[model samples]
Target: MRLTSAFSILCLSAALGTAFAASPVHTSGHAVTLDLISGQGTANGGLNFNGGFKGSKTFTVPLGSVVTVNFQNMGTLAHSFVIRKGGTVPTDADATDAAFPAAYAPMKVEAGLKTGMTQKVTFKANKAGAYYIVCGVPGHAMGGQYIHLVISKTARTASFN
Candidate 1:
């Protein structure tokens, strides 16, 4: 009985780990996982994130949460997904500055993944403020492919609204 119980516990733990690994947005004590899609629609001339454009959708998470974004490009054109420092529509310099090098997936700033490519990006929400998930391609963000990312000290969980 003891052996069986131990084996069962080990199996359960492994299963739970795998489940969290595959989840789109899974949050535990201090970690958050998200699946971010870029250019998912025709909105804003195909410049959009998660089907929302121009900060229409705001993703909120607790400050200090370890964030992992699994990014996928769904647009007809190549697109790069990146986290900029602010929520404003960026100038050419800001768009390709690669401010958060750890948060841009697939390549460096100004580099892009072709359509239908996927990559993972990880970072920490160390501060509470408004940020942006923008296209690293120059002029793309100004064309309206961006969304708001709010790292909130008061937010108890992760969500978008």
Candidate 2:
């Protein structure tokens, strides 16, 4: 009876360990995991990343730090993750094409993932300001597929003279 009990406990421990390992890590060291998903709503068919829109719509990271985005497309259609140099998040429908380039003429980083696919995108947060993360696919960003990313300056200690 004692031997059987010990074996059962060992099996249970292994199962728990596997579950924890498969779970997504929010922030691994300096890298942040951003999970992107599409086809959230039936009416507008929105997009979501890292539990935003219904949760937190803002992502904060340290300036000049390396950020990793784990993008996943859970929708039936393909999607892309594109970071532009701007602070405003567009609200109009199918206005991504005209509004995106007009405001953020130059894009910082961009990545694309097909339907039911995942990708890892790593970029440095060199700038300290608010940036807009949107779907590069046409009509996607305007369909409410965008989030605000705030890059804060590193904390520093001041010395009095």
Candidate 3:
């Protein structure tokens, strides 16, 4: 009877594992595409990304995946997007030095990306950890325009919160 009970428990655990494994995280091959908009809402005095400010939204992608960010400036102010190493909002406004090389907008102006424009930045998630996507424009991220980003070692697909 004890052997039978053990077998039943093992089978149940296996079944549960299989059920969870069947629903893998979705991904676009080995790529993750994301959209980010500046000043979609009246948050943080309009210093926001995708209507979220102060790291209100978190994005995650699998390690080694090529990530593409489709960035748009819909706000009234100049804004630029950049990927930085830390999650802390930088006290300074300069956010151009990206943690990962090639993880910044290609058409970024010194002032910022002008309002009513769009740009794209692509890079590989080579590290597994937390990061921040912030505005590279002076005084923009310092005013509160950034979001949390994470590269997961175990994640099979990309997701956002």
Candidate 4:
């Protein structure tokens, strides 16, 4: 009787495992891409807040789809990409107004470049909304080294302009 009970438990566990594995996991369909470049660092190959993007002015990606950003540093200094919720992205308005907090905002995922280094990052767009991507390397965001992203249930294939 004990042997039979053990076998039944094993079967139940296996069935539960299969069911769990079959369930779909929820993810944001949003995707992101960034071109990492120096943002006003040391002119002599040092880490400062002076260098910025040089090649691509803006990057357009699909909404609600998984985005993989391939960033590379084409300058002589190191650079980093810092993404944030819409509220945190730098704006022309008053600093006080931009300080308002919102829930479920995107946070920073650092991607750096060391003068020809490349980094890749992939994320799902779980929410149908818009967010800002920028280089938090001090003055880069203010100098227009960042762009807004719109995420939706259906993916978009046009430029984000």
Which lDDT values do the candidates have, in the order given? 0.76, 0.53, 0.75, 0.44
The lDDT of model 3 is 0.75
**Weakest lDDT window of 10 consecutive positions for candidate 1:** 91-100
Candidate 2 has a TM-score of: 0.58
TM-score per prediction, in order, is 0.77, 0.58, 0.76, 0.46
User: For candidate 2, what is the total of clashing residue pairs?
Assistant: 0
- Tell me the tens digit of each residue's lDDT in model 4 across 36-129: 3343444333332223232123334455556555555565644455444564545322222221232111133232445666666565555656
Sequence-dependent TM-score of model 4: 0.46
For each candidate in turn, give its C-alpha RMSD to the true structure in angstroms: 6.1, 10.9, 8.1, 13.9
**Residue pairs clashing, model 3:** none
Q: Ranking by TM-score, best first?
A: 1, 3, 2, 4
Measured with C-alpha atoms, the lDDT of residue 106 in candidate 1 is: 63
Clash pairs for candidate 2 = none
Q: On lDDT, who's better, 3 or 4?
A: 3
Clashes of each: 0, 0, 0, 17
Off by over 4 Å in 4: 1-60, 88-111, 158-161
Per-residue CA lDDT of model 1 for 47-159, tens digit only, reads 88877887898788899999988889898987886677784576433334544547776655466788898888788888788888778777887787888888899887677
